[model samples]
Target chain A: MSTAPTTEKGRRTRARIVDAAAELFYERGVSATGLGDVIAASGTGKGQLYHFFTDKGDLVSAVIRHQVEGTLAPQRELGLHRLADLQEWARQAVLQHERSPVMRCPLGSLVVELSNRNADAASALEAGFAQWRELMSGWIAQLQRRGEARTDLPADDLADSILAAYQGGLVLARSRGDLRPLETALAMAIEGIGSRRAPAGRHRAHG
Target chain B: MSTAPTTEKGRRTRARIVDAAAELFYERGVSATGLGDVIAASGTGKGQLYHFFTDKGDLVSAVIRHQVEGTLAPQRELGLHRLADLQEWARQAVLQHERSPVMRCPLGSLVVELSNRNADAASALEAGFAQWRELMSGWIAQLQRRGEARTDLPADDLADSILAAYQGGLVLARSRGDLRPLETALAMAIEGIGSRRAPAGRHRAHG
Candidate 1:
């Protein structure tokens, strides 16, 4: 074993393994997947896998990080600037869930599965959630700066509610095998935000 | 042949088994719990359990029904008359989750675990959810009549959102092994509802 695989190739291999693991983990829960499955899906031999990650827990942590970064990149790139366009942002979020109906958010699923079982996994999940919350909070703050969202609710709490509803919508959609709940919940949440600026009498429900 | 155990004592034993199964199912999950575990926890023998329940699935169905009724009865007793007291309602809901930090919602948990695997179990889960939705929708409608909630969002969608958030909060709380997420989510949701009547003015962030 003269020289280890080149750093570039090793990086590529690790990414491959993580991507494969993410897909498998989403389809079947983390508790149900195995190292063999990861290896087979990634098309990397056991030696390469072992070289890259010390154990299954290590691999799962990598997968969680990969998924968090992958999912967050889009929101940061496109959503940050579009905070004022609440309707469009809501539509995009709903579409994202509809696009992957069978596979709900992997970060959420992983958190539920591994939170109690593995401390490492729980930490990884918390990191992912914190990243999401921070991104969302920043977006909300931007909206406030633009006079888009209500300044009444603290930006952070509002951000948290939005995220909570989004996650909740995903769960409802998955359970019902329907996307209407997600659509309705998002629409209502956005409406809740917009209503903050309406006149007292016009503060009617917006279902 | 011995007489079938239909006596009062036999009925009590069967009820105990179902209650124990429901508790274990909620805590450890349906798939992880076994009939033997139920037998041990319920202080019932294998033959007695089989006599009461045809199989594990049968017992699971019974447990689902029992939990559904258990949850529903309290809400029914609380009555829709107090729907206007959103703050107290929200507080009570949050307190319910706080009371049992480790125990998940049995019906919701069952829906997630069994919806993908067993048809009968899925049906049972569906019925429970349907009943729950119905109960909530009824409460919301009553609130509308009492001028508590605006008729803007349909009762069904509003009920669904509340239920969805509750389920999502449970998942979030379980993942963190803490109840703050659940509490925060519920409090924010109630605040959103309360803010419905406010004019374009700043209110303190609830969470």
Candidate 2:
């Protein structure tokens, strides 16, 4: 039970199971989905399922990590070194959502569901988000060093705002199936942080 | 049988059930919270529950509306007329999240869960968001009329971005159990629209 899959075939089977679980859980939600559906979708038998995951709880942990990877895989493909990279990243992100208009942010939608139900799942997601944010902060820090992004606000905070806006925009877009809410927010966000080497006037800080 | 509550007592009972459902769904999630649990929490039997709602689906619709009201109640109490109102409103909004470190936006978290499972619930959530955005846009329009806000951007679009950021900020803050993400996003959002009447140079527009 504690052994790793040594064979490539075994690893493929496990990956397939995780992928199927992610799609099902993402579409039907964690509670509404069953292992049976995952098994059916994965085209794996019960013995194979048990050989990999101990229970639904175990399978869910794998799904959470899988989702984190699914969320970040694209950005990993596209570089994040420049301010323009951030804009391109957000556009690709929103366009990805356009393909599936009803889906929420891949890692974010799961946060709310598991935040209270499963500690392990929530921790896994939080760790994933922290890693993602750290990576994003590093990019923003580079931008600040290059004087392309604002320096007054902490790099981490700027990255957090970008990410927060992305998640919120996804939620709104998903809620209405409109796609405009997301497109508009991200455009404004990219503009908000993408320029202005010097400070501009604003009212009532820390609202 | 589908029926609306006619008597004052009937309405109160229905409201009580919805409130209980909202608390449970908000904490435990809609999929995890059974109607039986809702009945127990609401102190009503199965028959009474059925009288108010045809099934669990019906109850979820009511829960969505209740959550919507829960979100807007405070903001509605205080008008959204001025930029200061938006600031005060955001401060209260972030403070509300401070009370609970692990909960996402009240209506937003629900959006992900129900966006696909139940159409009625999703529709209810969309309507709620639309109404909220409309009210906010009206206030932003008011500010624009007074030359307090940038008039170049459409009032509705700014409202959408603000709502989108709020939802995303809540998701991020909830994931990390820190209020900074939400606070930063809102402060930046408030600042993003509060000024900059002239054009600012920026990178590629709308990646």
For model 2, the local distance difference test gives: 0.80
- Who wins the DockQ comparison? 2
True interface contacts retained by model 1: 0.29
* Overall lDDT per candidate, in order of appearance: 0.71, 0.80
| DockQ scores of all models, one per candidate | 0.29, 0.49
- In candidate 1, which residue pairs get closer than 3 Å at backbone N, Cα or C atoms, i.e. clash? none
Where does the lowest 10-residue lDDT sum fall in candidate 1 chain A? Answer: A198-207
lDDT of candidate 1 over A1-207, digit per residue (tens): 112346898878877888888988887666567889999999999988888788888888888888899888887777554444656766888887667645366777666555355678778788788788788778777877776676777776666667667767776676677777777766666655542555444443221
Candidate with maximal TM-score: 2
Q: What is the lDDT of residue B53 in candidate 1?
A: 83
- Tell me the TM-score for chain B of model 2: 0.90
Worst 10 residues of 2 chain B by lDDT: B198-207
